[model samples]
Target: MSDDEGAGRRPKKQRPFWQELPVLIVIAAVIAALMVNFIGRPYVIPSQSMEPTLHGCTGCTGDRIYVQKLSYYWSDPKPGDVVVFVGPPSWNDTYRSNRSSNTLVRGVQNFFSYFGLVPPDENDLVKRVIAVGGQTVECCDAQGRILVDGKPLDEPYVQKDYPWVAGQNAAYPRGRVFAPIKVPAGHLWVMGDNRNESRDSRAHTSDELHGTVPVDNVRGKAVFKIWPPGRMGPVRSHDPQSN
Candidate 1:
């Protein structure tokens, strides 16, 4: 074909940047929303509650984790899964009491939270599931180990340097030595690996559910840690059955 004819068949000129910007922005926003709402979201450890297993200490860079939102839809949370959830009302009262009450600051934080750049909710927490539904959970057997359904758990993940103890003055004072309690239906008993610092279900025994978190409150399972290149990998958990 002649040069003139070939030129006429060429692709149309690209749109100007100004005109394309809004469309690109909308597309980006939609993709981010879908990923954060349905697929997965990023969450930063805001406290040292999870310590040696998932660092989040003062003056230290916390671990950023990716939470998979779809898996729980296929199956209920199993014992040993590291999961995240909105803190129960009673739990939130203690944990989020210091969260900013300023609407403007909260608005900005919520916007970023939607993309998993921060925690999805200020009151959301992460912990390992110790028992589910009707299982009985208690701490500190003769060996100072957690027992589930009358079987002692073989937890290699509990922070060891920080010893586990029982009684009112123990590291996990509130949860250190609790009577065996049966988890109600659709509830989970969760605890932090850094038992010494975490304020998990064990710390709220006086609440209506007796410290068990409702299954519906769970957001998802934390599948991996994706921050600080040096500390990036899958988040591991021990199987109760394996014990």
Candidate 2:
């Protein structure tokens, strides 16, 4: 057992840092892509529209939600499930109107959005599903409540700025007088918990498909609020009717 014996066995060579760096980077890219495209990704709430359920107003850091992308692969987005989706063209128009006009600035924002590092796509929005395809949805029934399939939804999560003042038409215009409209096939009727501020399905009724969003546009279901520690918890799924 001398140098002559060792010479018979080739010495192992370690990979150079440069050679290994590319592999490491590719592996990381793959993992990040998989998580963002298939597993789950963090979405920052960018508006106060969802309120108490999700904060995004001035002076309040937005709530960060983990959207489970796989949830819809097994089943469709059901009524009462909170979800995120690509905004309709009309929505995008409105959102883009206020964003930076410079292409460079937008490029940076888009890059961050791709990784879930900043708020989701400026065109993405989160809201609760009030009714699914083929269901009839209307607001108010002498009680100023939202109804699905003629049954009042048990929505304890709704955040109203003022007390329900029944018979006050001005206070509940959009929330109270919506005609019983049927959701189209492969579409969803979504509304924000903060009914008063959200520009959801109700605001786009003039569109060709009324205000219902195409199911295909849905990104994922938000099953948990994972930010601000104190507010971290499983998001509640409401029942269509009160027991």
Candidate 3:
């Protein structure tokens, strides 16, 4: 057929790269948001609370972790799961959102947050579930071990123990101590591996919730450590009570 005769069947011209880039970015952002919100997400440890297991400290790159949101769809977080959760109101006494006050800047930050370019606007923390709903938790028996349901937890993951000091009238050296606390239904008692420096449940016992985190606050279970090449591996969720 002559060139003129084939003109009507010619393929359409493609859009310029600049013209399509925005659309491509939006599409990519949508996919990432869905994955983060429903399937899983990557989080950067911001503190040393979960030391030895998941490393992070001021001026450190911190361990980037993968949190799986799917498992909890059918099951509640139990003892041993390394979980990411929002700090309850009383637990956020020192937390301040870094989101910009400018609406446009905040929107941009929010957009980038889906791609892990910026942090979330929540006081998300990582800790191990020491006790779950309807359980009694307390610290220090004859030995310096946390007791859950009146049983001592054999927690090998604890890398550092809080320093011991004599109470005003105590007969012996003691670390932080609290009376047996019955965890309310639908809540959890979580703590960090670096007991010495971690301001976890033990530090918040005086709060209204008595340092118990609501199960609803749990974001997901931390399943893997994916940052700092040498430390890449599965994040352990060892059940201290399994023994």
Candidate 4:
């Protein structure tokens, strides 16, 4: 056959944008999704429950962080890890845990809510960790502040406007918590950086005389925030930074 005749039988040239572009994009998105869903995630701050450190009232006052789920795979939840968990009890006297909610839905939300993908639950609460099991956390400072391991903590993240003042007012009128009472082998004592507003383990979980959270109750640690461009950053412990 002649050279021109053979050339005429060849296939037509493809476009600059190959038809496979869609498939490639889908694959890339899937891989990214896998990394986000199972490897790391972001936690959104819904309310002022975790104020100062994480202000969520003024609009986009939250963070977008790479939450390492694998951290808990080897070690237990530390005293400073801002964990995301299911509230076993009604945190506020005005509200209670909804009964109709499905565990499956709750679990899914917990996984993707940080990516602006979905919300874990309408009642989710985010608070700072005050102490782990058996750590005595008392509000004995004349200024209504807290101390750990006999050392006075310095927290710059708290609301300066409400700096734990006690000179004019009674200190810890709510009552002093004599901790280090052995928070069970599998429990932890968590609190919000904003001592006055947070209804942490000190208030609700202590009714049973056990000032700690059970290991089973902990869902996972909040490593970072992925929402509110301005309020995005690592979810660090207020104790260490100040101390």
Which one wins on TM-score? 3
Query: What is the alpha-carbon lDDT for the whole of candidate 2?
Result: 0.81
Candidate 2 residues 58-135, lDDT tens each?
676888888888979988999888999998887666665434579998788767555655554447899999899989
* Model 3 / residue 67 / CA error / Å: 1.2
lDDT of 1 by residue, 107-226 (tens): 887787776554555478999998999899886677777788888987778753345444533544456778888999999999888877888888888899899999999988999999
Residue lDDT tens for model 3, 208-237: 998999998999999999998999999988
List, in order, the clash count of every candidate structure: 0, 0, 0, 10
- Candidate no. 3 TM-score: 0.87
Off by over 4 Å in 2: 1-7, 16-18, 97-122
Which stretches in model 3 have alpha-carbon errors above 4 Å? 1-23, 163-175
How many residue pairs of model 2 clash at the backbone?
Answer: 0
Question: Best candidate per lDDT, number?
Answer: 3
Worst 10 residues of 4 by lDDT: 171-180
Which of the two, 2 or 3, has more lDDT?
3
TM-score of 2: 0.85
Error of 1 at 8 (Å): 7.9
Q: lDDT of each structure?
A: 0.82, 0.81, 0.87, 0.60
What's the lDDT for residue 230 in model 1? Answer: 86
Model 3: colliding residue pairs: none
